[model samples]
Target: MKKIFLLAALIGFSPIFSQERDQIRERDEISPDNSWLKVGITGGVPVGDANNASSFALGADIRGQYLFNPNIAIGIASGYTNYFGKDGFDDFGVIPAAGFFRYYFTPSGLFLGTDIGYGFVTNVENNDGGLYVNPQIGYHNRDWNIYAYYQNTFLETDMDIQNVGVGVTYNIRFN
Candidate 1:
């Protein structure tokens, strides 16, 4: 009787063992492989104290990333932001040229990143020079990415500006 009971237990456990083995195999098949160059365009509005006004800006960035492992990638991007105003030359035009480090937290494409660089604001009456740091949170799916970020601009002169913006980026993937 004891032998019969042992045999039944082993038969019932066999399917679970098979499933575990299949899962291991599938995981190995899905291991991370990253070898691609990604380019994207972003457009959004900037709200700040110095501008005291709302303006729209567009940017373009290109990145070359090496996927060391599945979930980790490091890359650099250079981009520009142009701000337009309605009336005259006091409207600030900012060109943001920066480099960034990025990380993916999930395979579904959620990410966190930080960028540091110089922001050249042209056509300003009082101040024209500043540096900026932007920390951002974003999500990417197929060909679309969107983010919300805070920008701190430290001017060479006394006046400084802080901006909060939400942006949408579209990715153009070239094989």
Candidate 2:
């Protein structure tokens, strides 16, 4: 009876020990490569108050990224958003252009990044310019990606705007 119990314990632990050994081997075999480029499009709802009016903006963004190494990458993105007022006031449009530096934490392509850029907001007749900072979290696979970010818009005057958005992206890899 004791021998059968010992056999059962070994059988249960053999696969777990083998999996740990394989993970150690994988860590030793990882290397950096920089031969791929990915481009994607994303659309989402932007959470913010549009000039004291309770409204959310619909936004779309285009992204281009190049792998400099397995762990580091650089990219650029441009986004456009618009909010319509509830009353007879004018609608507002915003254009944001930014660059990003990304650090990948896993080979499966989970990343965190920061972006800095400027946004131009325009109404029917007047326009204003603001600087923006966005901190983002994202995941990338062979052909699919998703991201979420929070943006802060700082105008030259004292007006400040904050936005939180979540987006899903599909990538086209260039040959």
Best by TM-score: 2
Give the per-residue lDDT of model 1 (tens digit) for 1-175. 9999999999999999999999776654422244445566555566655555436655565555554555665656556555556444245655666666667787657888777777777776676667877788988665565777776667888766555666665544434
Across residues 1-175, which tens digit of lDDT does each residue of candidate 2 receive? 9999999999999999999999876654423243234434443344545546425656666667766656787778777766656566655666778887778787677889877888777663433868978788988665666787876667776665566777666655544
The parts of candidate 1 lying over 4 Å away from their true place are 1-37, 86-89, 125-128, 170-175
Which run of 10 residues does model 2 get worst, by summed lDDT? Answer: 30-39
**What TM-score fits each model?**
0.62, 0.67
Candidate 2 achieves a global lDDT of 0.67
Q: Residue 16's C-alpha lDDT in candidate 2?
A: 99
* lDDT values, one for every candidate: 0.64, 0.67
lDDT of 1 at 99: 66
